[model samples]
Target chain A: MTETVSRCPVAHDQLPQPAPLPFVSEDPFHPPQRLGELRAEFPVSRLLYPGGEIGWLVTKYADVRALLADPVTFSSRNRQRANPIREMPEDFKEQPPKPGLFINEDPPDHGFYRKQLTGQFTVKRMKALEPRIEQIVADQLEYMAAKGPVADLVADFALPVPSLVICELLGVDYAERGSFQEWTATLLNLNSTAQQVRAAVDELDQFMLRLVKQKRAEPDDAMVSGLIEAQDGAERPLTDEEIAGIAFLLLIAGHETTANMLGLGTLTLLHHPEQLARLKADPSLVDTAVEELLRFNSIIRVGQLRVTTREVEIGGQLIPAGSSVVASNLAANRDPEKFDNPDELDITRGAVHHIAFGHGVHQCLGQQLARIEMRIGYRRLFERFPDLALAIPLADVKWRTDMAIYGLHELPVTW
Target chain B: MRVELERDRCCGAGMCVLYAPEVFDQDEEDGLVLLKIAEPPDSSLDAVRTAAGTCPNSVISIAG
Candidate 1:
């Protein structure tokens, strides 16, 4: 007889389980309340991705800043390896086929491209655009006024101003904005399927390619034309593909981020009636108010995902080499250590040091431009419609939790 | 306060000019930081300090 060994069933309940990872909050306007708990308890905690991949989610301000500043150890170049999004298609696993935009590049390459564009976004440059931006604001407000007492603030005013400004800057035809805007929306949407994203990218690439060729053929005064001229004059001219990539980046990031800020920022002010009154009473507060709003909202939820190139220690935790890390900008901006009473919206607070545009080498290139737009946008909007209020109840507002960038899907308003 | 700026280090984020326009300016060509007032008045000190502190590149400094 075969020796039958009686085996006792092991208790499944006795097995050790990993601590629950905080889900990225579906509410875009406010970060998950659990983030605060996580920040206090585990500044650097193990994050389990939807696809079962494990990575680190950095919550504290100091660690986030350190990670952003030290690019060599936490490389943005290898985002594919570090990105916790398991749904990202396999084709996107490699570096983009083209040289790609500077935001996605590392040191030398990043420096080269950034240097070329720095002049275009100077304080002086942005100030010069102020009149045009103001005009854009005025026109939008007029359009909204004509529309009625109630309107979608996003569609009527917020989206068009920046879209037109960026169009004028890039030399892209504004008439085609409807198509490109749709493409951009699809591209930035986190829920967009792989096929949908690819289709959008292909459309944008074709559009940019045609525009770049036009610039090469007849160099105009626009940024794309200026880039073409600069490259042609350089010792090594950039390829058409490279030019297209840059144009694509500018067109998409230029409009979407600022547009959201304007729409959501107005909504934020409407929420805080006292702050709105303060701003309305004193227009000069626009500068500091913009900064405060940026800090409070921090539209870019999870800033650029990075992967560790080498073994490193962060927030007293030892993360192994080749591990993925995500720095929460929302968390960092709201860190009590960084900001006084981080939750409250004080328009007077000159929170200049907030990492809303990010920090270190990859800090936002269009920040000044965005600032001017906000300062002017806010002052003009309120000045025109001092009694602006929400058309629907606050609870009825649709939040854009699906997109990579956090904002309201539609902010309806009445004045 | 005497303000000094390292123009070459300026990546043109424009915090200096934005905060203390009276003390700082930007080059038209490259948008690098340009010190307008080396020794600003006592009233401008706060603005100068804010500019130096807010500079993303840490290229601004003050002395005397």
Candidate 2:
């Protein structure tokens, strides 16, 4: 690499040595052990990306918050270039995100798509779905009860509860969940090859396109149908492609995140028996427990990747324009300065401040819905099966170590 | 407590509504922050502070 004089405050040679991201930890609930050390020594540590680019991993709570809050300085538009966990598809590295896939976009383009759907996910709207969510949770528990004595909770309960909720919400036929679920698993897998990811994307696109057409022909009250009928402030109604793109984004995002949280969160509680006892003893602690679980799991383990749009200082390190940065929420949530006992699972901690749903303009859109699912999902699960325990040995449980979204592959449980 | 809001900056994450529904809400059309009570009662002070502090867009501010 040439020692070129650019916007960097220091010479290229003077920059900190880049280290590969620490990927594993002995404890499933905790982030990689090295992250804590790095957060202490270098909150904005230099990182070597899988594509052989040098990036920065931001681990401090305040710095992560600041970095995400300023989306203009640290833009999401170039996320493909900054992902430290895996090499993104080369074809997509420079292309602007497909219309309606606003998570990859910066405002006002992002807000254009986001705002259209924001009303659909408002707290009030999500709260209104509580009765339906309770029914879904209850029905799933009944399904589990019938299949129990030995059940993979990931399939029998955790996955289905959110899957059914999102399916009903999006106007997708719940019967077809198997196909989308398979494709999403492949898409979110960190180890998926470029070709495999491309294939999954193509399949999902086709599926959503067909669904969008159906919704147009036979409109329903669900989100996809609502999106089709309501243009909001757009100059023209959303095109078929844009609607399909939006549906595709929501379909994958809607289920996988909350499903994983449910699976992994249940496991986390099982591991922490005392905490589980407190939650079971007092069901009212469900809200705080959900927040704490989100904090503790930090399931979006790859962190929110962004490229600096200009030279900016994060944690005192001046990152130059176009440089990649991974804001490590996993480390941020566990920052000692922010929480009294960062790693300890304390359901009463009221960890609402943790950025598990992330921070800023592009924070998780379905957060309210996810919270509702978790709160209801956990309470119902424990209430239905008070003696729930792992049917298989802890070591036998398959962790989603290969995925961008952290979760359990199969959570074998019994009452 | 007097709650100040920059509705234009509100990204509609609904943390404010979740924390203090009495003081904040999302507009029916755009889901932007809609202040229900600019000066809330003392009973809701703690919840209002949380709403201001945790709003994703930091669009909410509180003053005595």
| The candidate that achieves the highest TM-score relative to the unseen native structure | 2
Worst 10 residues of 1 chain A by lDDT: A1-10
For model 2, the docking class works out as high
Instruction: Compute fnat per model.
Output: 0.53, 0.67
The positional error of residue B34 in candidate 2, measured at the CA in angstroms, is 0.9
Candidate 2 clashing pairs, residues 3+ apart or interchain: none
- Give the residue spans of candidate 2 off by over 4 A: A1-16, A232-234
Task: Tell me each candidate's i-RMS in Å.
Answer: 1.4, 0.7
For model 1 the TM-score comes to 0.91
Instruction: List residue ranges in candidate 1 displaced over 4 A.
Output: A1-28, B1-9, B36-43, B61-64
Q: What is the C-alpha RMSD of each candidate to the true structure, in Å?
A: 7.1, 2.7
Q: Write the per-residue lDDT of candidate 1 for residues B1-64, one digit (tens) a residue.
A: 7788777657777888889999898877677788887889999999888888777767889999
